[model samples]
Target chain A: MDVLLTSTAEAFRLLFSGNPEIWEIVGISFRVSSMAILAAVPPALVIAFTLAYGSFPGRRFLISLFNTFLSVPAVVIGLTLFIILSRQGPMGDFKLLFTQTAMGLGQFFLCLPILVCMAHVSLQAADRAAWETARTLGANRLRAFFTVLYEIRFGLTAALLAGYGRIISEVGASMMLGGNIAHYTRNIPTAIALETSKGAFAEGIALGIVLLFLAFVLNSLLQYVQGKGSINP
Target chain B: MIENFRIGFREISKSFGSNQVLEQTAISIASHDCIVITGNNGAGKTTLLRIIAGLEKPGHCEISLDDASPEPWRRLRKRLLKSVMYLHQQPYMFAGSLLRNIEYAARLNPALADRESSVQKAVSWAGLEGLESQSAASLSGGQKQRVALTRARLCHPQVLLLDEPTANLDSESRERTLQMLREFRDSGTAIVIVTHDPGVFSDLATSKLHLQDHRIQADDIGAADVVELDSVRQSKKR
Candidate 1:
């Protein structure tokens, strides 16, 4: 108990004392994760919208496939990308094996399914009348699509927050793809792992606090957005 | 004001899986026309209206405009979408102020030179004054229906297809909706209304049709009361 308390206290000290190294790892995590989620959102929304609204062959199969991807372990994705991006692999021409771009690529795949599946669920729960109403009101198909999106804006925001939370906190993918290099590719989760393994409990605990605080903030945001949309849902 | 025009949709066929909802049914709408359609639930009354509005894909259909040569429905669908508007049984209000709802329709109408005044006038025309800033989604059934008409009023669609415009309204709301509809028809906007209570629209309905056997037929006025309920159920079973 004393050890835990001591490390936790020192962790806050390091966090608030303008620790450059700790903040750099935090910056890498956010930059990679933010770019990944931003890149994943548009394509995920299109896929989810197609699954929810379009009627075509294999649509149901595609929906099921995405839902299945939601449960896939992050390590599995990390390993798959690692092979594909390795020196001898098909994509090896890029030579992006142990870089921030690799970490971003891993996180992108990790969050794509999450955004797709969750957005699909939100669109499914949306009122069909929204689409019909927009069409009848002289909106073209594209305008009508945007109208429906606006109707379910709160739900989509929730999906976005959930996707960001999952990718940012994931350790396995960042560690495997980013290689946990000191100040270059290192992120919060990778740094936590390295610090803990080196018996540097204070550093690990500080990073854990950041993750925990982030989880709390994201969940609070989710709850607030859900409350705004609870009536529609 | 809408331009004087006529549209004839021939051979509208729509099916959901094995269920044949509409089978080569036909209908026509001309300027200043009020066509009322009556049928039991699942008789595809709404489907026919939707097809006329170009909001649904038909198995096959053809459209002829103003004595012109017949063209495939797929070809004329864009024209129909531009000129026709369909109102739902329970009107859906966008997620914002009532003013925003009216503003949306005004924005779609490129011909409207002054959108601000046009929208304001429409709000007053629908008796929706003092409620401009309120969330439209929170309005009562009657208020929502009025807002829908207000939107229709702004766009000036050549044809308006409404599904049960007075389904659950009290007498006051029904009267308000009928008054607005009467003005729409007078302004040369063709009106197609699908209702269980066709009697309410008796004054304005220029023609009445019954949906039966997956077809639209000129309704025999007295015969409908006796044969409608049983025949509709029988047709569903077929």
Candidate 2:
């Protein structure tokens, strides 16, 4: 406990001093997660709308398949991508292993199911009248689709927040696929893991503090977008 | 009857699982005419209107305009969407102001010139002058109806399918709605209004249809009759 107390104080000092290592890690974390979400959102929305409103063969089967995938463990996803990116695996020709892109690819898959599941629920709960009304108002399929999407914009925003939250703090895929290389792919969560294993609790504590702050900032932004947070600041 | 357009529906049917609604039904609507559809609750009146509006596809059905008959439903799909507009019992508002809802339809129509003026005219025509900037969700029932009417008017569809438009309105609102329908009819828009209130539609209906037992029966209400048949039926208690 005494060690923990001193280490926490040192962590605060490192954080307040604008440590370069901490900043680099935080920046990498943000870049990878943001890119992954950007890649995931469009496809997630398309899949979700198709599942919710479309009438086609195997729709029920596809929905059930996605629902089953919703519970897939993150470590399982990391392992699956690890093999796929490895030299002996099917996708090894690209040699994307141990790169930021590989980690991002894993994170993209992780975020997609969350987005599709939540957005599908949101679209299902939406008023059917909106779609029919848009159609009858002389909107073709494309125009009516956009109108329905607008009606559910708030829910879409929430889906994005949830997806971002899921990927930003994830450590498993980043460590495995990114190799946690310092100055290249080391993110906050990976740095915290490395520091804690090495008994450098100050760096670990410092990275943990930054990660917590990141979570706070993300949640604050989300609440503000949802019209639930303080506007004073 | 107008030669250029006539809405034809043939042998349309629909069901939800084991429960059937419309079963092998047909109807034809001409331009500048008003048809009142009447039935008891769950008698498929709304379903028929939905099929006519092309919002719901019939189980075994075909529809067309003019004399394009026998499997012309495929051809009807394209024209059905352009020439028909449906008004729900409780109309839905797009996510913005009243003006946006009207202009949304106007934007899609390539022929609507002076979009802003067209929206303004629709608003004023519906007697909704000052509520332009308000969110459509905040409007009263009658105001919502008028907004929906304004949307339909801006689209300028040749056929309008209304499902229980006056079901929830007050007497004054109902009268205002009927008056608007009269005006639209005068401007040569074919209207198929579904209502249980016979008094509201008596004067405007060129014909009356009653759906019962999954079949459409043309009622004996004469074109000149103005009696409230629904009210009289209600007093007799079935």
Candidate 3:
């Protein structure tokens, strides 16, 4: 307990002391995760909307498939991409192995199912009247779609926050794909792993503190958004 | 102002799996006409209204406009959408101020050359002048109905389809809705109301129809008739 307390205190000092190395890792984590999420949102929303509102064959199958993907282990995703991006594999021609792009690619696939399933739930919970109302008021199909999106904005925001929280803290995919290359692809989770393995618990604890803070912030935001949308809140 | 029009929605067939709601239903609507449709629960009165408003797709549908050639319902969806508006039994308000809700319809109408002034006029027309800044969700059922009417006023649809506009309102709200609807009829817009209480609209309804056995029956607005609508030959003799 004494060692743990000392390490936590030292971690805070390192975090607040303008440590270039730690913040660089933080920056890389945010940049890669932000890009991954930004690329995933639009397609996820479309798929989610289709799954919720569209009537066609295989819709239930797709919904089940995405829900299944939500439980996939992060390290499994890392290993699959590692094999695919290896020189002996098909996509090796791109030479994307051990690069930030590879790490981003891994994170992208990781968060896409999360965004789809959650956004699908959000769309399903929304009233069908908003769409009909907009269309009957002379809005084209596209405009009506936007109107419905606005109506469910709170739920969508919560989905986004949940998705961002998932991708930003995952260490397995970043470790295998990025190889923890310092100052290039090394992110918070990867750096924390390396630091702890090397017995540098202070830095590791500092990064852990950041993750905890982020989780708290995200959960708080999610609570507020859900509260605003609830009828009894 | 909306141009006068006569629309015939012919051969509408809708079913939910094994349960058929409407089969070979037909109805004709013309400008300045107030049509009140009554039927038992589950008789598909709302379904027929939605079909006329182009909000639902019937199994096989055709339409004739102003005595023109009959066209496939799918082909004239945009035209129907432009000229028809359907108000729900309980008005669904968007998440915004009342002004925003009114402005939403105003924006969709490209004919409103000056959107701001048109919205202001509509707000005042609905007697919602002092409540423009209030949240739409907080309004009573009557105010919501007025807001829906305001939205219809801005759109100026030739056909306004209302589903139980007075079902959940108090007496005052019901009277106010009727007054507004009377004004809508006087402005040359065709009003089609689906209600359980046909007697409520007797003073203003130009015609009344009954939906039974998956069909809308009767011929004239001023006549008291309820016959099966096997194949309504809704030919406009104009």
Candidate 4:
């Protein structure tokens, strides 16, 4: 308990001191995760809307496929992406292995199923009248789609936050794909792992605190949005 | 001013699973026409209106416009949607302010020379001026209906399909809604209303139809006949 308390106190000191190295890792984590989620949202929303509103053969099969992927192990994702991005693989010609782009790609795939599943649930729960009203009001199909999307903006925002949370803190995919290089590919989770393994408890605890702080902020934002969405006044 | 418009749908049928809601339904609508359709619950009155609005796809359907060749409903659905506005039984108010909902429709209408002025005019026309800044979804059912009418006014659709536009409204609100529908009809908009209480719309309906057993039966009553019937019903109530 004493050691833990001391480490936590030292962690705060390091955070407040604005240590360059620790902040760099934080920046990299945010940059990569933000890019990944940004790249994933549009396609995820389209797929989710399709699954919710579209009538087509194999729709149930596709939904089930995505639901199944929700529980896939992050390490497995890393391994599969690793194999595909390695030399002699089909995509290996891109020379993307051990790069931030590769890490972002892994994170994109990691969060896509979550985004799709959550957004699908939201779209299903939304009133179909929104789409019909927009169309009947002279909106084209694309405009109607966006109008419905705006109607369910709260749900889409929550899905995005959840996806961002999942990818930002995930260790296996980031560790494997990024190679955890200092200054370039190092991120919070990878830095924490390396620091703790090297007995640098203060650094690890500091980064852990950052992650916890982020989780708290994100969860608070989610709750606020949900509350706003549910209450009419 | 609205131009001459005619829409006719024939052989329209819709089924969910094994239950058929509408079968071989045919209806014709023309500019300045007010058609009040009455029916029992589950009688497919709403389905017929939705098919006319192009919001629902009938299993088999054909459509004809004014002086144009008859075409399959699927081919002309986009055009049908452009000219038709369908209001739900409980009108859905979008998530923003009432003015925003009106502005949304006004923005889509290219004929509205100035969107802001048009929205303002619609707000005043609907008596929704004081409520423009209020959240649409927070309004009462009657207020939401008014907001929907305001939007429809901005869009200026040639055909207005209403599903129970006065289902849950106070008498005063119902009268206001009828007044608005009267204005739309006077402007040559084809108004199709599905209602259980057709008496409330007697003054506005040019013709009455009944939906029974998955088919529409046209009644020969003219507007004057409906108005007389409504007075009789009112006198009986007194």
Candidate 5:
């Protein structure tokens, strides 16, 4: 208990003193997560919309498949991508393993199912009238698609936040794929892992605090979007 | 003079599982025709209009516009979509300013030399002028209906399918909407309205179609009702 209290106090000082090392890890975490989420949203939206509105033979199966992917273990994703990008593996010539790009790629996959699942739910819950209304208003398919997207913007926003929240706190994929290389690919979650393992509780606690703050902000944004949806309706 | 064209639907049938909504229904509507489609709930009056508008496909249905080849309808839905407009019972308000909604429809009509002016004219015609700056989603039910009508008018569709258009409007809004419909008819657009409110449109109808038990209960009114209805309209105008 004494050690925990001392670590907590030291953690605050490290955070407030603007420690350069801590700031770099935080920055890399944001950069990778942001890029991965940006990469994930467009494809996720297209797939979700297709699953929601399309009547093709495999649509139900495809939706179920994505939902199944939503619960897939992040460590399993990391293992798969690590193998693919490793020195002895296929495409090894690119030497992407143990790099930030590989970490982002892993995070991209990690975030995709969350985005696709939530976006699909949003699209499914959207009013059919919006699509038909845009169609009969002489909007071409593309325009009608955008109009439908606008109708469910709240759900999309929540999906984005969910994806960001997942990627930001995820330690397994980032640690395995990124190798947590110092001054390069180390991120908040991995730093917490390393610090705790080394018995440097202050650093670990500090990183955990940052992660918790991030999660709080994302959840708050999601709540705001949900409130907006209800009030507008 | 407005060119006369016919909207034809042949043997259109649609079903969800074993529950058939529309079955092998045939309708041929001519220009300037004002059709009042009446039925109890779930009678598929709206479905018939949707099939004609090409927004929906019957399990097996076909449409031919006037003497035009079926190829045109098959090949150019995006380009020719302007020829048909459908108004929902509760009009959908897109997430934008009302003026943007009107402008979006107006952009589709290539014949409109000036989109802004035409949108303004449509807003005035539909009595939706001052509401232009407001978010359409915030409008009352009557205002939304008017905005929908304004969009349909701006598109200048030869055929307008209205699904229970006056279902929730006050008398004044209904009268205003009816007057707008009269003007559209005068300008040679065919109007097909699906409604349960016969009293609201009994005097304005050129033809009445009654749907019952998933079939055409009655089509093309008897001559006597048409004559009486016309005289009633004439008397009201005077």
Candidate 6:
């Protein structure tokens, strides 16, 4: 307990002192994860909307496929991406292995199912009249789609936060794809893993604290948006 | 001041798996026309209107415009959707304020040069004077109906299709809605209303049609005869 308390206190000191190394890891984590989510959101929303509103054969199979992917272990995703991005594999020609781009790609695939499933649920819950009303009001197909999306903006925001949280905190994919190189590819989860394995608990704890803080901020924003959506005021 | 326009949908049919909703339903609409359609529950009145508004894909349908050759519904659906508007039984107010809902419609309409003033005028015309900033979803049913009409007015659709526009309104609200419909018809917008209570629309309906057994039985009474019939019905009610 004494050691834990001392390490936690030291972690705070390191955080507040603005240590360049620790902050660099934090920045890389955010940059990679932000790019991943930004790349994933549009396609995820389109897939979710199509699943919710489109009438086509195999749609049920596609939805079930996504739902199944929602539970896939992160390490499995890392291994699969590692194989594909490594030399002697189909996409190895891109030379993307052990790079931040590769890490972002892994994170993008990891969060896509999450965003699609959650957005699909939200779209299903929205009123059908919202789409019809927009069309009748002279909006084209794309405009009507956006109008419905705005109607369910709060729910979609929650989905986005959830997807970001999952990808940002995930360790296996980032570790395997990024190789955790210092100053270039090392991120929060990977750094925490390396630090703790080396018995450097203070750095690990500090990084852990950042993840926890992010989770708190994201969940708080989600709850506030949900309250605004459900409550009249 | 509106240009002469007419739409005729012929050989319209729709089926939901084993249940046939509408079959070979036909209707003709023109500018300055008010068509009130009445039918029993599950008689496909709303389905027919939706088919005309291009909101639903019929089994097979053809559309004719202003004495032109009839074409497949698919070919003319885009034009129909642009010019036609359909209102729900319980009108849906969008997420924002009443004024925002009106403004959304006005923004889509190219004819409205000044969207803000047009929306304001529509709000006042719908008798929704003070509820501009209030969330539209919080409005009463009658208020939602009026907001839907106000949006329709702002868009200036060539055909306005309404499904049970006054289903749950009080007498005063019902009278207000009927008055608005009369004004829409007078402005040369083709109005098509599907309702269970056709008597309420007696004054506004240029033609009364009944939906029965997957077909529209149109009662093509002359304008003077319809006025006389309305007076007799009103006197009988009193």
Interface RMSD for candidate 5 relative to the native interface: 1.4
Interface DockQ per candidate? 0.64, 0.68, 0.91, 0.77, 0.61, 0.82
Proportion of native contacts present in model 3: 0.88
Say which candidate scores most in lDDT: 6
* lDDT by residue (tens digit), candidate 2, B1-238: 2234566677888998799998887877766667788899999988888888877777888765466655655556756777889999999998778888878877877787898888788889999988889978788898899888888888888989898889889989989998998888777788898888866887787777777889877686432222223332223222
> In candidate 5, which residue ranges exceed 4 Å CA deviation?
A87-90, B1-3, B69-80, B107-111, B212-238
> Which model is ahead, 3 or 5, in terms of TM-score?
3
lDDT of 3 by residue, B1-238 (tens): 4577788888889998999999987787888778889889999999988888888988888899987998989999888888899999988999989999999999998988999998998888888999999989999989999999999999999999999998988898888889999999888898999998887887778767888999887735433323222222132211
Candidate 2 chain B least-lDDT 10 residues? B223-232
Runs with alpha carbons beyond 4 Å of true place in candidate 2: A225-233, B1-4, B72-75, B221-238
The residue pairs in collision within model 2 are none
Tens digit of lDDT per residue, candidate 2, span A98-119? 8999989989999999899888
- Which ten-residue region of model 2 chain A has the weakest summed lDDT? A224-233
Alpha-carbon deviation at A15 in model 1, angstroms: 0.7
lDDT tens string, model 3, A1-233? Answer: 98899999999999999799989989999999999999999999899999998999999999999999999989999999999999997899999999999999999999999999988997898889998999999999889988998998998898899889999999999899999999999999999899999999999999999999989999999898889877882
Candidate 3 Cα errors over 4 Å, as ranges = A230-233, B219-238
- Give the interface RMSD of each candidate: 0.7, 0.9, 0.5, 0.6, 1.4, 0.5
The TM-score obtained for chain B by all candidates, in the order given, is 0.91, 0.88, 0.91, 0.91, 0.86, 0.91
Model 6 CA lDDT for position A65: 99
lDDT of model 1 at residue A6?
99
- lDDT (tens digit, per residue) of candidate 6 on A57-151: 99999999999999999989999999999998799999999999999999999999999999999999999999999998999999999999999
Worst 10 residues of 4 chain B by lDDT: B225-234
For model 6 chain A, give the 10-residue run with minimal summed lDDT.
Answer: A224-233
Write the residue-wise lDDT of candidate 1 on B1-238 in tens digits.
6777778788789998999999887777777878789998999999888888888889999999988998999999898888899998899999999999999989988989999999989999999999999988889999999999999888889999999999899999999999999999889898899999999998888777889989887774433342123343223224
Runs of candidate 6 exceeding 4 Å displacement: B219-238
Candidate 6 lDDT over B14-67, as tens digits, reads: 998988988887787887777788889999888888888889989999989988
